[model samples]
Target chain A: MGINSVTTMSPGVGAKLRRMHPLPIRIMHWVNAVAMFIMIGSGWKIYNDEVIFGWLHFPEFLTIGKWAQHGLQWHFLGMWIIFFNGLAYLTYGFATGRFRRMLLPIAWRDVVATIKDSLRLKLSHDDETKYNAVQKLLYIGVLLAGVMIVLSGMAIWKPVQFSELYFLFGDFQTARLIHFFCMAAIVGFVIVHIALAILVPKTLVAMVAGGPIVSDADQSGARHMNETGNHP
Target chain B: MSKPPSRSIFRPSGKIDSSILQADPKLLYEIDRRKVIRGAVSLGALSFLTGCNVSEVDQVQSALRAVSTWNDLAQSVIFRPNHLAPTYPESRVVKPPRFNAHYNIEDVQPVDVNGWKLELSGLIADKRPWRASDIYALPEQEMIIKHICIEGWDYIGQWSGVNLKTFLERIGADLSAKYVAFKCADDYTESLDMASALHPQTMLATKYAKELMADPFGFPLRLRTATKIGFKNAKWITALEVTNNRPQTYYEKEGFNWFSGM
Candidate 1:
């Protein structure tokens, strides 16, 4: 979603909140963060069972549940939490039109310029409420990767029941490889995400509170209101 | 907190000679401390050099293997040997049923069905070789079921065969034995739990797609079931053994799950 995504709270023209993320969004964001870490840590331990390349391991210190049995327990627990949380988040986002409105006008052409600007560390403090092209791309990429990871995970866990997904992943070991790489990419993205959050502390605070402490630039900028209001 | 005297000890300065140690108690104390420190370091090295000490790698590997063993036991408990695999409609069957083996496709040689006889051994009451005619006369059934592979693909195929449970009974096999092993002509060995061997879906498949099996399809006879992966199917059957000790299959020795019950 882009800057145009809906916040749905209309507290008159000059309200206290500056029309930032709503409370549910912030709460879900924290839940997702914790879930992701658990999944990754346990997944690394499981991967250590059969090292993919030449005895390489993620190191016992860096992983959760160094033992296979205990690691799988942690993994399954994380999987359920993430799966259900994602389901609820997706359902609410699409139903309220927040997903589309928040991520709108994200053109593919702006990608290269955004990358260049990010490399140079060039940014506008005023655009904190709005998403830059690079931020939008990263968010969208993570969302897509999340879906792929889930599907590949299911295929590996239950190949017979979900035969089509198994085939899509190009076989069992191939799916495992995809799953492992997807985890690594997401981990990298999260590190960058945290660093960026540190750079822009205001955004982090807003996410924590789920309300804009700053000013809403536009009167009717959010598309969420229109999308839901029109549906009724 | 830098002390010039402490730094001079390792520097081998002649300022602290044997006569100076007797004259000054501080120098004697410092020399004794150094002796204790050196002893500790030497003891640490000796312990490591002895080779009886446990290593970090060994501990972690054992921990993981222990967990794997626990997983195997847990999986075995949940296994429902009596459960039947779901059947599908004839229209849903996948065509050109997948050909799989440890070797290349061209390397598969054809067996002479004319002189072929299904061998029997182990705890079986009847060790006589049965000709194709004898096997064909047994009561058979047909099923259209999905066959999943360990490599991550599946295909629906029509398999016609005599029910393994019935065949085992007809051959007077020791049903209570721990394992039912298939020793294939292809040199591939596969085994199943006595319960899995008696599963309703488990069969000694005689025909595929309503036709006699050819070279690629495990001609003459094949093992068919949806309970296990494709590699465990054990094609081109030559001998069947009923044994108390479960024999590990060719793939199982390669670190694949033994039960492998999907």
Candidate 2:
């Protein structure tokens, strides 16, 4: 169960072991992080121009653009980046079986247990390579939110041309509300995500520079356990 | 980095002596001195932090504009000529439709109906001017469509007038032209792509909510296209030009997207 026991190989051989995060995943993650930041900042500026809730207005310093039009320019730029980057990430995730390997089979029982342990501050961070039930749920939730934000954005952008999507969210006003909530969900997720990363700093480093490596046998063994419904 | 020397003659507290203010009255106009200084510093810091020059900033802006232009092209390609903007029930129409313009409602100059003439030019076969009476004589089409503003507000408006495509055909306009540009009485100008100009829902709207549109709400005639954002719907239209050349609109000149379709 020790780190040394998991990898009995030398440094050179350790280099050959599967990385906790592959190069492509790491690149996509960072690119998405920048895109998300730009999108959120500019989106806030756009929202402030005409707020849904009259009482709420985001501060100017926290926003990306100096004016509403300027915010629109930044928002559009961020939109293109996030759209293409997200498409690439999804493609890579499904094609490479990354989704199956990293995030799958969320049992309600396990999720409830994970939540209970998390509340008690007894949740383990022993396996940096694998995501716990809570982590899996969060990742999946944020991913869904990302997709919803984009779709709702499209609905808002072209309510006439993309009328199907517009009606899917009921109306133009409702679509805007949906887009706003999706953004809120993403911001919340990012706050928690960053806080957790700070608590367990290695997770942050793992995303940036690949963390502990798993040997071929260990990876396949983990996959076998996943398939046989014996995941620890 | 070494701190730059202070350029302001004002005190560190930003307090100006009355004698200094009297010495140069122009100093009184520098009320945003702090803001200007902060802006300049931030601009410098931004360029330094990003390792970007003024030229690079310009390059980034041009690139974004290019993307916006590309979006315009993409929208046109996907724009179904026959596809209609969603319509609403008659009950949903807002009475006394919200007024929006570059200037205030009090500043809206009412055009004399008798003196008003719809001038025609550009690629049209007939360049003759039509009076307001002539426009009213044309077959009127009515629509209760959502008027969406770029600022994200929307309202159901019941607009009724001559269908633009029908009017264009009657006026002997070259429908093949790339653009249909409008010149308004209020000095506001707007243009639409040929496809949008020919849309069934696009109209030379003269009435709102079953009444002649008020002066502040584009009286006489206006371009009311459901497919475009509210700004693209020019009010108080005085002239129509059919041309291959793209006409620069008032808002477009101010950096708003030209083809601001819904």
Candidate 3:
């Protein structure tokens, strides 16, 4: 129950818990992860040809004139996958009570305790069951970032339909700048998340096997798999 | 301890029994539960995946194009289209509205309105020049039509101008001239295929809203071509050259589409 007293449960306990995610959520999470990575990589190569950065003489696909257009094509195609995947995950989260488990905090007291324990690296395996304050913050940040990417992408893509959005970003060029920056933020966050997963083996196993070693030591029982939404 | 036996979940139930007994009980129990869970999940997922058809991308790009093309063909269809650009009332007209896009005009030397002449040259048997007054004396038509900006805003106003078709006929344009290229006073140039240039609605406007055209809106003379985005209507005319090939404009030179016709 406490930080120092993480009683090791039997080997079979990790295999018995009911999975928090249905299969749909799991598939969507992994598919979206792959799509987002490809989008970012291809996006970078395409972004190099932009006039805004032309002064840097950034080398890109040397023979191609409009690398940006091709980048846009890939980004647009990848968008379909990410959009549907996200929609499925959100519907499942709301339909099942799982949204509250990972999304809504148990209480502010738990949040405060999480921050305190995380600050000292004294959190037990059970403590990770409920997201730590930092983890919660990052999770919320990434979701909001996703929304920003969608909105800004639309603003740039269909500036005519959303005139006010053009006013918000000042112009097409400005909207494009913001969209690119938001994508970079998401990529950076994902890298940090993967590093953290590798740092904790049980977190990885729980996501892959559908249950964590802390089965007896925790209340939620289900380990967080789709945190960064990278699991297959 | 042996690893749990793996069998195709979708295979007939008969194949599963033989594979079931040769596995660890704990691992087998988890696998059995997973299989049943996955089968139910696959069904639900199939339905959900079908429901999750986010067609916004397809809708936004092709919907208007499809509607316009349909109207062009089915001329008898009576349904008023929704995406048609709105017509504005005269009372709502903004006096001295800000100019939208300024290009080569700002950097170029001004053309003398008095001495200015439109030179009809390029792949033509005869090169002729027409004065502004000469063009003004030709048969004129007036129509209060909407100028729809590609930026999603539009203004309906009166436009009085000579038909481009009349001028081309007078010049006896060469048969090989497949395009009509306009050379602007501001170093901006634009070209259109012979088909678009000869459209009855396309006019080189001289007046706006029953009054002399405002300077900011291509005063004295400008092309008021319909069926294309607003940007195609280049302002502040200086020369018009009929040609058999494509020409470029300021924006087009800077990576914009060459043919912006609707």
Candidate 4:
């Protein structure tokens, strides 16, 4: 979708928007969504040291023995999925030059203006922009944190082969500490992202439907060209 | 023109297919409900089915077995060209190193050199016994190696002993034998796969860190498996059995992975 197509629509008249997200992007988004849930679930199972599947008739003390090993195998396999998905998304974004659209420094003036507008509770009515500077920065931070998590994970996984990396991280124990902290940070960001979606329902709708769920009353709030939506 | 159904009418547009919208709203709602119920039911069924055959503990036990299986699988796939752990320079040795397990090997009663008989049985045509000096007579291999414990910490030390494979070759193990189970003086016991047992680097150490091994360290006899984890290197060695069957180590019987190695 072209940038101009996003803004030229008229206001004050309800008109359905055509597709906003390209098909490939939508597919990647959904796959990533499903894969993430599985990774988190299996990951939890692996982390719970005392949790042993005891339903099968077995003596005590044996539960931790096998459950922990297999859980790691599954976790590593899921990791590869996340790695490939991130690689594809990054490659596509860079190739299309849309990477900058997701995160580019807005003028400092724009950031200050947006913050002021938000504090004034005018954010709901504020001319909807794709992503504010603060939002872009947050996204970039999350992306970089993911890379750090993967790198630290690798250092711990093969400390011998990645001896230099292991030494740099101050050995396996230290690397594990950093990896865990990064995971917590990522989870915290996810919680905030979901909260904002609820606060701004239109953004969530836009993501799923590839168009704003423009109400009849708000049609006037948008630009005039959006009335029929044909202009967009 | 008939206004498209108002946004208030619950019509979602764009990427959501129109056919989904065209379906009767009640049917759609019912389908969604059915989907939720079916999903829950399937999940419950899976849990129950798996539960019927395997308890939570059984899965854990399976995982323990998998650790050993994964080790074996790794060995089969990733052939180590060198099959050797790195040899550190003598200067790198940690002097007066803090030792953990088997540090006080002298505490145990010394095995009578003459009475001590190394039993070779299981997947073999005949059982044989070797005197203490007989094993000592073999070419002594001296090298520094790490004893990495599962709990986490590791210590580098010198090991002076003969290759267990050399002993295996001398005895002439039966073709069926695939593992060597070390029955030790203490309650502790361990088993090694044939490839690991036969690995040229594996040794039966009589000395630790270049000193005569204290009794607690299995003086005059101890299994030193360089390729395997520390647990497999049993102290106070008493008997060595060749076996086709998967030998039961005390830990392995308790669900620890048999092959605990890199």
- Flag regions of model 3 displaced more than 4 Å: A1-17, A45-47, A50-66, A106-129, A164-174, A205-232, B1-262
Model 2: share of native contacts present? Answer: 0.54
Candidate 4 per-residue lDDT, tens place, B1-262, comes to: 7878557556555566668667688777667777799999987886776553344556534543554566556554543424565556666565544334433534566666677777777766556687777777788888776555543345666788888777777777764577788887666788877777877668888877677777556767888866665667887788878877765677666545566653
Give the residue spans of candidate 1 off by over 4 A.
A1-156, A159-232, B1-69
lDDT of 3 by residue, A127-199 (tens): 4456665676788788878878877876654443344564688655677778877987898899988887788
As a whole number from 0 to 100, the lDDT of residue B53 in candidate 4 is 35
Instruction: Point to the candidate with the largest DockQ.
Output: 2
TM agreement with the true structure for every prediction: 0.52, 0.82, 0.46, 0.60
In angstroms, the error of model 2 at A53 is 0.4
CA lDDT, every model vs. true structure: 0.74, 0.85, 0.61, 0.63
Cα lDDT tens digits, model 4, A1-232, are: 3445655443333544333344566676777766665455545445453222334233423222135445454555456677788788778877854556446655788778878877887655343435776677677888887778778876655454345565679755567667767766777778888888788887666567655333323322223235333442
Write out the backbone clash pairs for model 3: B178-B244
lDDT of 1 by residue, A1-232 (tens): 3333333333244543334677777777889999999899988887786676766788898888746545665675677779988888888778855656556558777778877776797765565656766776788788888988998888776555455567787656788888877887798899998987899888788788754433333432332233232222
How many clashes (backbone atoms < 3 Å, residues ≥3 apart in a chain or on different chains) does model 2 have? 0
Residue-level lDDT tens digits of model 3 in B210-237: 6667766776678876545577787778
Q: Between the candidate structures 3 and 4, which one is better when assessed by lDDT?
A: 4
lDDT of 4 at B196: 74
Give the alpha carbon lDDT tens digit for every residue of B173-229 in model 2.
999899999999989999999999999999999999888999988989999998999
Q: Count residue pairs with overlapping backbones in model 4.
A: 29
What residue runs in model 4 are displaced by over 4 Å at the alpha carbon?
A1-148, A151-155, A159-232, B1-44, B47-76, B79-83, B94-115, B123-127, B174-178, B198-200, B253-255
